[model samples]
Target: MPRLPRADRAADAALLAGLTVADPQAAAAFVRRFQGAVYGLALSITRDPGLAEDVSQEAFVKAWRAASTYDVRRASVLTWLLTITRNTAIDAVRSRRPVPMGAELLDQLIEDSLRSPDLAESAVHRLETERAIAHLHHLSPDQARAVVLAVIGGCTAAEVSQREHIPLGTAKTRIRDGLRRLRAAYAGGDLEVDHG
Candidate 1:
């Protein structure tokens, strides 16, 4: 029988079923169909393009391995694949030793975002994100580093302490105080400058 078109859930299920059975065409089709979304989610979670690419590859491998467990009634193929991508990306992030994220790094990211042709509407969203990141500069360097490590790097308090070579309590205090200040600044709308 001829195959159905590639855009619908049923077709997605077929592609996954084909992948489970080790069909090369199905595997190729599946990757071609979802690579963008998979990579996008991975990049968003990991925030590093190189690591995101690695995570994306791992997610696809995992999906291929666990293809038999996919259930259409529970979720769509895209959702299932993206979940694997997210988990993989988070794992990658957690496994790495987090370094301090400074204003220079944030500025470079913003500059890269501004230059991307893909930033059509996301430019506004990216600007908002840049604004929030810029607010980190208002913090003392140590507090800012602590907050970035704990929040953006997804490090636990103990991990932060270990990385920063500080006491756990101090790391927690920094994160807490930094967040409190940021909250106040955001609420008061006092931090309008990008400072990059």
Candidate 2:
């Protein structure tokens, strides 16, 4: 086995900056440099070459869309891109699996998880769920509903828009803002929920 050469961090960062502005040459170069690694990771996670190809493409698209949000202080370009690939692969795999529970059943499960403490093996999961639910309650009603439909229901933003009778952008904003609040609150320990 041979060790791969170290990444040129400055060059990669410049490529990502160019990608943020839709520079075609930078996009091509970035893809060329990372496609093999991205596809390899996707294939390992998805275990399907065709799905891996799709995941790899989607991961690159997501990277392009999110390029402006990339933080050099947080991670190198390769590490950040691989994280996107990993998440995209997981989402692609999850989408293929059928959820056994219907909406009512899912709602019931959430309710039970919150109120019942007797499920000894899942105590940690239940606590996390409880905390999440508490944070959801803190969001505006519209934001909370949008987040729930898209996240818990696994519905897309378009679906949430249709269900909520709002524009697509509005639905996306609600979900994004809701999640941002939850993340901030969780990170800052600002949630007023009783964890005990």
Candidate 3:
């Protein structure tokens, strides 16, 4: 999306200033101008349409609440909106935990794979795995760790719960939510993969 021009910036600043003095229309216009960019950024980071929508709404609400603190000297309105989106997404990711997997099952799979060829195909697989890991990091630390354990560690929901010290249901939900976000991020072109 094109950045708002300087002239528009001045107008927006003026509108925001008016809003501080109780101009409802100016506040409405401010929301109309920046809501799309905020939602887009949230969607890019969270990867769930519903979650993105909620985050977008929350971000705007935050902007409205914090409008008095907005200093045009520090950054553009869009920049401030995006910062709120990013922080909101990160917060959403952190509060949730991941489901656990069976340690014995994972060990069995590893043992079973020991006889498989560790050749060019394995190298390619490793590279793809690394790319997935990189994408996973875009999530909040809790989500990322849960996703890594579920995808890479091959842990079951119960196992993840035990390891993370969270309830089984919470673990499961986090793993499911993380996977959903991962798929959304990959499909939305927010994440790049190295096929080779």
Candidate number with greatest lDDT:
2
Q: What are the candidates' C-alpha RMSDs?
A: 9.4, 9.9, 14.1
TM match of model 3 to true structure: 0.45
| Pairs of residues clashing in candidate 2 | none
lDDT of 2 at 84: 89
lDDT of each: 0.71, 0.72, 0.63
Our model 3 lands, by Cα RMSD against the true structure, at: 14.1
Which candidate, 1 or 2, has the higher lDDT?
2
Provide the lDDT at 170 for model 2.
Answer: 93
Q: Write the per-residue lDDT of candidate 1 for residues 1-196, one digit (tens) a residue.
A: 7775543333778989998889887888898778887887688667789999999899999999999999776556776787688678767876783553444554444344333334552443345445556677777777877776665555678867887789999999988988877777755657432221
Q: Pick the candidate with the highest TM-score.
A: 1
Model 3 CA lDDT for position 73 = 65
Rate residue 112 of model 3 by lDDT. 29
1 or 3, greater by lDDT? 1
Error of 2 at 23 (Å): 1.2
State TM-scores per candidate. 0.49, 0.47, 0.45
Candidate 3 residue pairs in clash (backbone atoms < 3 Å):
98-171, 99-171, 100-156, 100-157, 100-160, 101-155, 101-156, 102-156
